[model samples]
Target: MRPDSCLSQVIGMTFDASVCDMFCAWGAGATLVVPARRELHRIVDYIVDRELSHWNSVPSALAIVEGLGQLVS
Candidate 1:
């Protein structure tokens, strides 16, 4: 999708090792929320509570979600 089209979707993106890519994405108008750690429960809670539509994370972060059984689709 076009970057401009994602302006309305509040996206929670993790910046563990890479900052440039994440920053560029955020600069394109995607609302970004960076958590303190790889806390899947907290991340999911934040996303759900804030009604976020997208997220970007490392594979390890995805594993956390899987381990907690909180993967949404």
Candidate 2:
């Protein structure tokens, strides 16, 4: 990841996935974008608005987004 890469922190800090999210960005000096409460319901909008370059999450989380028809090519 580049220093300017905007990586999304979709998982909570309590979860193990969050560790990777943080380290991946911090290790490479990239930007880690954490979503707010309001933005949670509109993940796609937040992603676009934030211009996220990377998103890290579990398969189920992705399934939720895909099921919502929010995953665009």
lDDT of 1 by residue, 8-40 (tens): 222333534356445655777655445444433
How far residue 6's Cα lies from its native spot in candidate 1, in Å, is: 7.6
Best by TM-score: 2
Q: Model 1 off-target regions past 4 Å?
A: 1-17, 36-40
Over 1-73, each residue of candidate 2 has an lDDT whose tens digit, in order, gives 9898999887888887689878999999999888877886767878889999998777787777788899899
Lowest-sum lDDT 10-residue window in model 1: 4-13
TM-score list, all predictions:
0.47, 0.82
Once model 1 is optimally superposed onto the true structure by TM-score, how far is the C-alpha of residue 43 displaced, in angstroms? 2.5
Q: Give the runs in model 2 whose Cα sits over 4 Å from its true position.
A: none
